[model samples]
Target: MAEMFSMLGTWNWLVLGLLLMGLELLAPGVFLFWLGLAALLVGLLSFALSLSWQLQILMFALFAVAAVPLWRRVARRNSGASQSNPFLNKRSDALVGRVFTLEKPIVDGAGTVRIDDTIWRVAGPDAPAGSRVRIVRADGASLTVAAD
Candidate 1:
């Protein structure tokens, strides 16, 4: 292993980088890709400067660590720009502003509404049963409503 490290060349780093990147396709968690990127950087750098194998390994380690913060910044920026759906897993949030009829009368600011075979607890001003109400807000399993 020491001899191998001592004999490290640009091609070796490049091949190792490519192999790591290829492995990422088989067992991916966005980890190996960074290491691959670091190796690739070291390989490319070796073309311009003569670095010892130990220095190359050190540069690879530095690049790999640096990639984490870079990746986080890029990911955060991209994620904020466009989101697929704001209400993907939050079903209650999607119900806001939708109008539904109250199945039970809202007495003392409490009532129940049935929406798509699911009974939802509602809180709002007193209203009679069968009255149409618009969802003003959703808090977990409870919804705040207003007479529509």
Candidate 2:
């Protein structure tokens, strides 16, 4: 293992960097990009001044660690520029804060509300059919509602 480290040259570092970056295309978790950049920086540093294989690896590790904070800061600053839809996959959440008539009578704190063509299970006070109810929140597949 020590000999392998000693034999790693500047070209080896560059190749390793390219290979790590290529892996990013395969498994895109946004992590390998930082490691790839680290290897590339080490290669450049080695080109300027001859460095031992161990030193090159140390520089790569340092650079990779340093890049994480920079990436997080960039993501934090840009997060508000275009807000992502938090309710994209949550269908029940979209029903909250809307008033809908009870399709079925609410007996024993259970009922159903018809929103358009879809019938959704709801939990609230007992009420007769056609009574107006306001959706307060959603719990999994059920909506929590109250009298509007």
| TM-scores, one per candidate | 0.60, 0.60
Runs in model 1 lying further than 4 Å from the true structure: 79-85, 100-148
Q: Write the per-residue lDDT of candidate 1 for residues 12-92, one digit (tens) a residue.
A: 889989999999999998889999999999999998899999999999999999999988888898887556777877999
Q: What alpha-carbon RMSD in Å does predicted model 2 have with respect to the real structure?
A: 4.3
Model 1: lDDT to the true structure: 0.95
* Per-residue lDDT of candidate 2, residues 1-148 (tens digit): 9998999888988998999999999999989988998999999899999998888888988999999998899889887664566666787887789999999989999999999889989999999999999999999989999999
**C-alpha local distance difference test of each model:** 0.95, 0.91
Stretches off by above 4 angstroms in model 2 are 1-3, 18-32, 44-55, 78-94, 115-118, 128-131
Cα displacement (Å) at residue 82, model 1:
6.9
Model 2, residue 12: displacement in angstroms?
Answer: 2.4
Error of 1 at 69 (Å): 1.9
Give the Cα error of residue 45 in candidate 2, in Å. Answer: 6.2
